[model samples]
Target: MLMENLLRSKEYWSLIEHGVVTAPANATAEQRQAANESKLCDLKVKNYLFQSIDRAILDTILTRDTSKDIWDALRRKYQGSTKVKRAQLQALRREFEVLEMGESESVNEYFARTLAIANRMTSHGEIVQQITVVEKILRSMTERFNYVVCSIEESNDVTLMSIDELQSSLLLHEQRMKGKQSHSEEQALKVSNG
Candidate 1:
């Protein structure tokens, strides 16, 4: 996709799509000039492909006659079959569905975990919405956050809340929980020492 975008940006994609142009012996001067220009563009595209690949892969494709051949070879070598892709997507979906925040995990840590799976799913062609992620986080948080989750759900329109906003709110609640626990511990220590 990156190579395609680059070629598209430079208007060189047609050379790859249509192969190199060849003017016949009886062709007009303009026809010959156009063919020459197309061959030059094909070489440029080939150069770009050669530079992007590693030494080992380049060696395997060195015998390919044109940029289109090289591109097709690379695509076949790297792109998995439909069945394999489907299986991988299924696994990712299961992982996302079972995701839950760990007892000692911080808000950022949980968010990172969830978003990583979500991103992989997205790359596999799944449409993961922000609201779905937010709702998942809210419902899958540790039991200690139950009150905070309920309060947030009650006070906010979750459908409109961005993931960042939800994360920020949960992080503030987590900090307050930690602060209260530490303060209580300090009070208990003072009483015992007294």
Candidate 2:
């Protein structure tokens, strides 16, 4: 959002590189005025960006004079090194690969779990392809979903199916199974009470 604002206002140049006051000593009055205006604009943008940060983080960067320094500091602290990113991605991949639906877990819960790991992987610069996610869901769901999973695998191309489609199918099956169980319980209760 900050980047969007900067881009919209054409003020991104201040953040993209180290901004320097470009006023020359021999410049005319108009040139000096324009230079001062540019400097003021840069300072305003820098201050705005700084103000958006939390107080605790603000303390860490209060001594940093330039906007570029503050931006780099924040980015480095959050983004980390390449090695750190690789390790984070690897951990997310392991979590995703080993993910399984608990026996009593609902389709929504399972999908949420899977998507969380996938999103983390994406944040760490890994591509969580839909096909990969679909295959993982197809293979990792509880046994209750086997029939529907088989039907899907047989009738639809799992490679081409979106995660939403698979999730909807599984959720429908889950709801139907739950309904049948409730109906069977009611019948059993009626027989016993009768």
Candidate 3:
């Protein structure tokens, strides 16, 4: 969260791209002042970053001079190298492969779980296509959802269909099933009474 906020700030842009100023040996008064101001700005940004993070991290970066150093250190520690990212993505892929809609879970719950993992996969640099998600949803759902899944596959372009549309259809089907159950209960009560 702090990282996201810092990335959004102007100071971060300056630190990462232009970097802090360094006054030359033969620098004029105005030039020295400008360089000092730039260094002050970097310090303020670094302080804000330190405040946002935990004490453990603070200790690790205490020796860092500029905001750029702190930022890069944090990024390296958390975001990891390319190999680390690849390993993370592979783990997420395994989790996705075995992801199944629980028999007792609601339509909303299942979609939420599925999208969370999908979003994580995307964050880790895996390109999870809409069609892949749709196919996963269609195949991994409970046995009761077979009819709706088949109908969706037959009537709509699964590749073009968004996850929201699929969720809506499943939610509607769940509502209809509940309504039918209540109607059947009413009919049974009436038959017994009459």
Candidate 4:
């Protein structure tokens, strides 16, 4: 061991040139046995898991119906999610179906190409009958959007102040007549004086 250390100290790379590992020739039997035991231990632990480890785990998962756990696992997998994403996707689909949200160009393009349709519907100086139809459609769509966004609890304001009642309360005949006196005697006195 002293001789090997002396050689290693002299020149480190000289041992490699001479094709030799400067192991301790005078090592005790106990030291040699310990080194051998360590080598064996390392060899045994090498590549402990077989290639089938992944297949085994996959097989166990496939055989089981882990629906309850799956829901939990899926929830955990997706961190910080509010509502599930679905409405915008549906809206996009509707847009594609209608071509309004799809292969459409612009308002100018629509007018230029669909002149007869525009003329028939009376769109923007095209047709006269289109106004009522468009108004009715707009009213229907407005009511639908309002119904969707508002809940029953939020609709109490609408039930209170109503237009039908307001219209009924208005005395239209009294407002329309010109110089209609409250008392008929005043009118007769005015006529006699004249």
* lDDT, candidate 4, 77-193, per-residue tens: 432232322443344334323332113333233223333333333322223343332322223322323342243215334335333322222223224322364456688988999
Q: What local lDDT score does residue 107 receive in model 2, on the 0 to 100 scale? A: 95
Tens digits of per-residue lDDT for model 1 on 67-153? 888888887777678887789899999998999999889999999999999998887778999999999999899999999999999
Best by lDDT: 1
Runs in model 1 lying further than 4 Å from the true structure: 1-74
22-101 in candidate 3: lDDT tens per residue? Answer: 89999999999989998988887887888888998799999988888888888899889999998999999999999999
Please give each candidate's TM-score: 0.71, 0.77, 0.77, 0.15
Give all candidates' CA lDDT scores: 0.92, 0.84, 0.87, 0.34
lDDT per residue, candidate 2, 59-178, as tens digits? 999887666777778889987999888888888889999999999899999999999899888877888899999999999988888898899999998878999999999988999999
Point out where model 3 deviates above 4 Å.
1-11, 28-37, 40-44, 47-59, 182-194
TM-score of predicted structure 4: 0.15
Clashing pairs in 1: none
Candidate 2 error regions (>4 Å): 1-54
